[model samples]
Target: MLAADLEYFQDVQNAYAALTNLHCIITDKQGNPITQLNNDPNVFHLVYDQETFKEVLNQWTRDFSKINSAIVYDALPGVKVIICPISIQGEIEFFIFAGCLLESTSKNTVQTYFEKILQNPEKANAIFTLIQEYSPDEIQAKLRKINKMAEVLIEHLATQNMKAHLVEQEENLGELLHLIADGNIKVTAVLERFLHENTKLDFVGYARKKGHDQFVIDECILPEVSSTLKGTVFSMGEGTLGQAAATRIVRFWDHMDMDPRNLFFQQKGIYPKSLFCFPIILEKEVIGIFFGGSSQFVRLENDISRVGKLTSSLIKVIEGNRFWQKQSKNNLMKMTALNEIFQVMTDVEDVKRILLIMLDLSINLIRGPFVAVIAKQSSRNSYEMVSRGLTADQIENYSSDISNRYFHNKQNKRFYHQQPVEHITSWSSKVLEIPIAYRTECFGFLSIGLSEQMLKEDELSFLMSLTIAGGVSMHLLEATTKVKMGQTVIDLLIEHQEYIDPDHFKQATKARELIKGFSGFSTYGKINTIAVKYSCYFIKYDEQFLTNKIKNDLIIDIVREYKLVADSKLEFSQASLNVQVLSLVWTYINEDENIDFLLKINGMNLPLLNEFLAYLSHTTVVESEIMVTNKPTANEPKISKHLKLSKREIEVMELVLKGNNNREIAERLYISEHTVKNHMTNIFQKLAVNDRSQAIAKIYQMGLEPEDVS
Candidate 1:
């Protein structure tokens, strides 16, 4: 029994020895040491102290932090040992104290003990001598390798945790991408979800293009805080995210509080403590930027790498989606262009009108700030109106400037020699050049303005299409302008007989009174030069031509006649008529018609007297008998034409014509009923009318309607 007990004791000693350098001490319940292994026997007494012994025995009841630091005390003369509690049937039996090691021990010797423990004591002792003979440097180097192995084990465990986290993040990212692709998810929603799910990070903000600037926010992910941060500019190199976007790189700032002082954060009120910004690059261009931050400073290499990888992956997906989006947009733009072309072709007769509509459409479609069609001017200074999105004031100013510089200057050879240059305006120094063609005799320059963000190939393509479409629209507009001019000239000739001839004027009045019982037909005889030109050029010379051609065929006749008679004696003759007729039409046409006709013919040439007369005859005619009968009375009526209407009658008549009730008229005119009645009774009797419609009709007949009389 003594030999057996000794063998068991040797086994325990060998087991203790297997943990070489690492002190091991076993103490009984009575606080006496049962076994101790180490070069220093003093470690057993120190480790088996009452306090340490009780702590080791109370493992089941103690917190983990309290038990984690248990180590042999004598290793450093004061350090305690790590204790492993051994129990027998739920009762404290003995405590195994270990983990203290002298700094002088060779790390390889410790490792050899670990390896030898798998084998036996003979092998363990054999390896121990070689390990113990190693120099301090070699032992440290060996310890580093062992530490590296431990680190590998820890890394494996960390990797498992990372995999689980990455899986969840991927799912979240996938959902966000789905929402973005769906297009129903707003930018705010996407950012909010990302920040909310990514509990480890605080989402700072995002940036998007708005007109000529970038719209940035501080806490768009948090709605409660977004309003305070909106409408802020994140210019290039301005903030972390801005810098990242500007440089097209990932930027990591350890501490934002330590950032260099600048206007970016100070003015923008975006002072983050720690920040990570990544550029959302697509097609090698930074389209947007994303930022994540923390309120406290923390460095996470793994997190940085993960974010980089995730951003890169997301960028790839976004780029692919952008490609498809561009394709779809291009197709949609093409279809829209075609539709606009069709609508303009069918809807308008004036090329200028069509061009204007086209400019508006292009501006809206491309979402550009400005659109213009620069066409070759007839004179060095006089470019024809092609199309523009410029305001009236801008058009006038531009036209005046062009006229002053180039109009009719024979020395200006550049007009015939050079190609039109299309330029897009910039907010500051840089002007982005949109690809366009500039050829000699180029129809016009089509220019559009874009937001500060770089445009993609598809956007450029759409712009090119707009320029091309402008050309088509311009052509259509010119053709329509000519047709409308001719129609207007015809309409004037048909209505205004007085400007044609006093005899024809009387006859037209009689004819109109006989046919429509309305003397306003004479108003149509008012002839603008453009109208007379249209009559000369486009009207077929015949009796039917007089009736058909001189009736609303004004624009066509003007352009055709101008072209036909531009160089001949008839050209001069027609030119004179064009001017005289335009003047006469200005004087006699209804106010609305005059305004419209002046707008059309304000800059056109005139026709000669003979052509004007000819146009007038075709346009206006009276019965021969009426002309004969009215010959004597024409001079007298011409004198009476200047008679003035009384202010009261004018006021009463105007209100009556406006359909105002008598009391309302009285209130508006500030007159009593008896006076209003007197004025109305005289107005009716003098106008030769009894009822309201007839009175209105008679007023129109007298050519006294606001537009007609004016």
Candidate 2:
């Protein structure tokens, strides 16, 4: 157990983890997980990615070892854990990842993260409900518990390894275990130390089996032999070395002649009276052979057992290096691959494509051979499953269960779900479900067959990034499909505001469901109805590039301008692709004043828009019957934003409404009559009216409409 007596430390680990509600794991210096079966199953609510946690440990060694008590927020998914250096004596022997227990830093942190990133309140709330909320004092108390755990673990480790001194006792078996477990010791170093530390042996040679027929001296301590016997090859079953290779056991020739036993050695003018050879076996097969001889009578029986154990330890050290090295490379590659997948996921809008990326990412994240995504194609479609690494029969079985049970609850709202896999070939058979959702719309869930039930912080966070990406893609695709729904659907949704007939208006009904899926709405008289219209001469565009530029600018202007009022929890789309028209109804939550975003785009005193089309927008304050649910009523008066016309045009319109002529308005304003007439003309053109009477009526209707259009 990670080169320490952790068998005794298992209960301590589980107790601390259960008591503090922080994920705890101990890894050796090189970041390999120390197997502890007693880790509390209920302690972790999210993921416990072994590879990602190892990466964190490696990062600590490289960048944060000095700051051992650092609590890394967003360390794993939405988790914060402090990395404690589990030291023995003065050197760090292991690392303990302790928890402060959070999905985000605080409630405010979660809100801010979702607002700018996914901007999904349902997800934010789901997270809030799962995580154990900690106050300042409570958090401090949890942290103290972590520090105390670290202290106790280190104290126990030191006490356990303090029994014997390595320097005084040369052949202690525990010394070899600790030495090879350091992870930096090379195989050559272990073999060399085996002979160099023993003064009784005159020469040594480690011959690895090549081609299963001959053995070659891959490493040698026989300096007295001629021609550097490092690469010496000999036939098997001929001498002591051959006998060791033949028998797969320790072979000692204590009373043999120096001429025949060291025949290969005597070929190079070397002579030894006694010699011993042994097979280095791994998994019950001879991998190599080690031979050494003495110039005098050696006590072969006394040191044979120690040497056999030493050879086994040597093989493990070599293999351990190779294994960890390969693992490190694979982890780096997985991270790079995950980043690429996440980047591609963000740009993709198709449900199938996004789920495909999620499938690829999930398998790599958990090394799970099978992964599946179960979701509804749309509001009307039946549940479907997308998967990787499963047989057709398995898919059918899983999909039936998931669609009928997982999707059975039409009103299912959850953070996550874990279920035991039946007919398990191993106890490691466990399944985890992370929903792909945005706001409260769950398109489907990522059902992952995990190697273990525990999910890492980094894994959950990484999966969270995928989940959020998929959710956003689903929502954006739905919203975009609705807004550009060929004007037929949009017209139907706008004109027929009553209950929709499910059979006749399928698209409109689905669009309304999508609208309700975005969030709940209440029928109130304060919704901002933002409408954008084009000028009469706006058709002065011919070039494709020029039209594209104009369309892009107008689309940006429409969405950006609409965002002026609703501001938060709003996803807008272009109502008309050709004219850049858009309409979205939203009200501010927890606001005290009414949303009165007045966009007054008049040609008079209008700044020229570089070289492209000039955009003019006028807002109508239509009191909506649909207000966002759970929003505060406005106690303060309405705050009017940008107006339709300039100050001069507004003043001129006021005089016109007051039954004054242009000359009287000019006298009152101290401006020229031409200026007053020009202002009126600009107002008429912007409002798209011909006469003063129509202009006044349009302005009055647009500026202050008190009708309940619900």
Candidate 3:
């Protein structure tokens, strides 16, 4: 689709060049080569690469749609120039370029150039001399007439093409109109075909008013026509079309010499005897004059009126079609814009690429000479160029200036409104400021040079969508990175724990505090569960004894170690060992056959133990506790009541009644220094004097024995 559009535009440009005897080329706003006719391709490459040249071109296109022979010296090093902007559908689609003169040239070259320079002082001087020799007043009048003719020529061409494009729904009609208005050969062919088929008169040729003063004709058609009507404009009330266009009324001349009322008609040259003029009314405004004349001396009042009516009706139809076509095209452009945005969303991941794509798309849609994405800098004097169409060196220079003004100053957002800079080049010749913001966070300002055509709502909406989409994607990417980091830490913790020593597994549990905190898993239950799982092997290996004393010692040790790990100053005094005893009993019964000595020593019977141990080994400690606790509590209260003595007394009586040794209690408690002797002395005194066996016998008599406590 894009290629076909370019080809159509190229054909029109070529036709314009051939008919007008002028060089022409079409270029993008950035000065990049799109298509060229009767001009060097390298010219576009050179101009586009030169920032200064592009800036000048941008300025020229902004002011007018046509520059017949205007001089623009800033483009190539050794080139004179005439440039015109060819706007279509509210955009500068192409520029018409002509002339390339070197600084130094031969006399013949200068003469050729002089003839083409429309208002050159040298040519004016020669014409003025001849007029002064003849009649000074007449000379001044002729000069004015010539200038007016030039203006009319330019205006006629410009308005005709604009009007034709306005009416026709034909694809590439804009280009076709441009070619016809410029008096191209193809347009002449088309007009010749129309005239030959529609009229009996010998067609002289066609001419279009370029402006208020100048008229242009197809130089290619001048030779074949019999009359000298090419490249000429009649003074007001002088010729058929000129009189009608100047007076804004219809005019007809039956004979050049015989018509008494047509005082402006001259008999000095061969001229059309009968002529009719009609005003081309467009949108209730007379845009130009249309003349259809012949040498047959025939009356054309009815034909003139009919043609005038048809042309007027045609203009109205064109205007209506243009209005709706523009509306529909804009709608299509908006839809295309939406589709492009969707594509960007799914295709881009790299932030830099996304930003560049956004910038490129914006420039294309808006048809601007420059577009850039600027990122906010942290420093007060610097900003980063996230993406831009400017050349590398140009971007570097612009970045340096932007850094000094906005980035270095640490301004959140700033607008540079039409601030003229020698360095930065764009189409507007004036800077446009648009701040790039997401929510309240301002990234930076996006700057572009708008041509004569301002950006529409759809263009702005497209830009806004790009900014929002880019910001959201960046945010999501950052969040994903953090999540990945967390997962990595968790994985490392799990891996490292596998290599940790069973006895030193407590350290791993302690280290998990850091991981839990990092991962946001700081709830009490969760922390406790993790700590227990991580340190379970250590507890099982070291504290497997079910005896109350040993279990009580282990609990004290565990509490002390926990306090040390926790870095707490608070001490854990003696606590009941019942829970530890139950835990230890469960651990021993649950040990596998390979470590079954643990169960054998805990009072398991041989064959029955073998069968039960196998079954119990597969069971969890929690499940075994459920089984044990559910057995029976019937005799438990009676036993608990008989063992109502103080803890120290129970210790002494159990040892003494068993007849082992008094020294054992003292050694176990680490309370030495006659503590065991005193405990024995108190036992005998409490039992009413006695030997060790008598004391034990009395304890049995009093029903205070191991059976009751157990």
Candidates' C-alpha lDDT:
0.46, 0.53, 0.44
What is the per-residue lDDT of model 2 for residues 1-710, given as tens digits with 9 covering 90 to 100?
54335653565667777787665776676666574533443223333345664576677565545545534445644545666677664577676666535632465675467556646666555544545656667767776776777777675555434323322223433344344434445556656666665667777777877786787888777655555567878767867788777877677766555355667776766677778876765434466776777777767657554544445435533542343344556544544554455446545667678777788777767767677887786634356678887778777777776666546655444433222223232224456777776544567887777665566544654565466556655656665444453322223223222222333344433423422322222222111121222211112223353233333344344445444323433322222221212222122111211222211221211111100011111122223324435532454211122135765676676666555788999999999999998998888888788876565445444443211110
**Candidate 3 ranges with C-alpha deviation above 4 Å:** 1-327, 339-343, 376-389, 403-407, 411-428, 487-710
For TM-score, candidate 1 versus 3, the one ahead is 1
| Ranking of all predicted structures according to TM-score, beginning with the best and ending with the worst | 1, 2, 3
Q: Write candidate 1's Cα lDDT for 410-488 as tens digits.
A: 5643452222233323222222222222222234444454456655665554444444444434444444454444543
Worst 10 residues of 3 by lDDT: 518-527
Number of the candidate with higher TM-score, 2 or 3 = 2
The residue-level lDDT of candidate 3 at 102 comes to: 34
Report the number of the highest-lDDT candidate.
2
Give model 3's TM-score versus the native structure: 0.21
Give lDDT tens digits, candidate 3, residues 575-625: 122222222233333442223333323332222222222233323333555
Q: Where does the lowest 10-residue lDDT sum fall in candidate 2?
A: 606-615
Query: Following a full C-alpha superposition, what root-mean-square deviation does model 3 have from the true structure?
Result: 39.1
